[model samples]
Target: MIFMEDVQQSQATIAMPIDRVGVKGLRLPIVVRDRESGVQHTVAQVSMSVDLPAEFKGTHMSRFVEALEHWEGTLDYHSFLTLLDDIVDRLQARSAHLRFVFPYFLRRRSPVSKAGGMMDYTCRVDGYLKDGKLTFTLGADVPVMTVCPCSKAISDEGAHSQRAEVRILTRFEGFLWLEDLIEIGERAGSCQVYSLLKREDEKYVTETAFAHPTFVEDVVREAAKGLDEHPKVTWYKVEVESFESIHNHSAFAVIESDG
Candidate 1:
């Protein structure tokens, strides 16, 4: 005769919540709409994240990469929203966030001779979703030539000229291309900078900027005006930074979104 002993089992315990979990600095190729042209191909550095509830100890890190792989080709407002929604659903989380930064090139025509060239602009897009509600933001860093107004006023011979970068961030209610923000920044500066410039083009840029000298503060205000008039943009922030030629420090100005 044989006998068997009874076994005891332990009770299950719940795990603690993670504050934030996701991926970062993921490089991928993407295509975006070019205002002058129809489409442009570029690479983007992307980041995605989601909030973890108090009941969950961790999130599935692999899921974020998997989601990105699916929609990494053609990126747009609609595709971005769909990706965010998928992340939220797949992770079973209340919120999801996405960020992408890329270099966008635009073909530009010379003011005088109408010579054509390409200018590269740094652009970024961010999206977030919570409780099925979504919000999207677009941004760009534009480089231009800024001739100091005060320098021009005080100096008799020549005014101080420096390279300035203007950054524009805006929340969009509808579709808006990165090129739009770039144009706003270019118009705000004394003159827009270019990647390739011949002697004639350089002369035109210098004279044009000297004729329309601007301060850092002026650039921010002007950029704000352009953003205000745009119908697709719901909110915006304009920032200008000039690399001072005389001094080591740079002059900067910022304007936040009120409308």
Candidate 2:
């Protein structure tokens, strides 16, 4: 057998420590809990890293994949923290970070039509482990419909209504489902958008938006209010971006809680 030299074990010449060193853009299949179903399968773009000491020249990149491959359980809040622990132990590091970005689907029934369709929401699960403490943040991007209040008041014909996205990131003390955040985002808008809408559903949504005209600022404020009212949510950040139909530029607003 030939002896192979491990270059990563060598001492670093720069004498500087790296905050994070690992892999990114790793695609993996994971299962998550669904409100209606028992579980749902989805693909995730995963990124994992750990703090590197000044003595180490580099981290073992292959170890990141190795650890992720061993993760076979459902991806949930508890399991997410466990995965971070596995990475930290495998890398022999003081701190570790893990992020998974995936598209979560929810079954929706169109209003007035009773049509069923799947709605996709971009979600992210993040974990940071340091000093034996773990911090978890869950984020979701929800699409909704919004009407301009100013345009509705002056215009005699119609109002400018467009699609907007509400992004919510929250840190909670207890368990909270992704649907919880998504519902808050949807309700914050003038009207909820559906994937499939028939003629009657379209009329209903259009009338709903016109009746509850709101600005982008209103969306974030409403989302913040929902998070604030929740007892389990310790901290939260809400961002609303509207793709204006009348203008080329998009309107956006952001709000964050003190805690």
Residue 64 lDDT (model 1): 92
In model 1, the runs with Cα more than 4 Å from the true position are 1-19
Clashes of 2: 0
lDDT string for model 2 (45-88, tens) is 99999999999898989888888888875898778887888898
State TM-scores per candidate: 0.88, 0.96
lDDT of each: 0.86, 0.93
lDDT of 2: 0.93
Q: List the residue pairs that clash in candidate 1.
A: none
State residue 23's C-alpha deviation in candidate 2, in Å. Answer: 1.0
| Top-lDDT structure, candidate number | 2
Q: Which ten residues in a row have the lowest lDDT in candidate 1?
A: 4-13
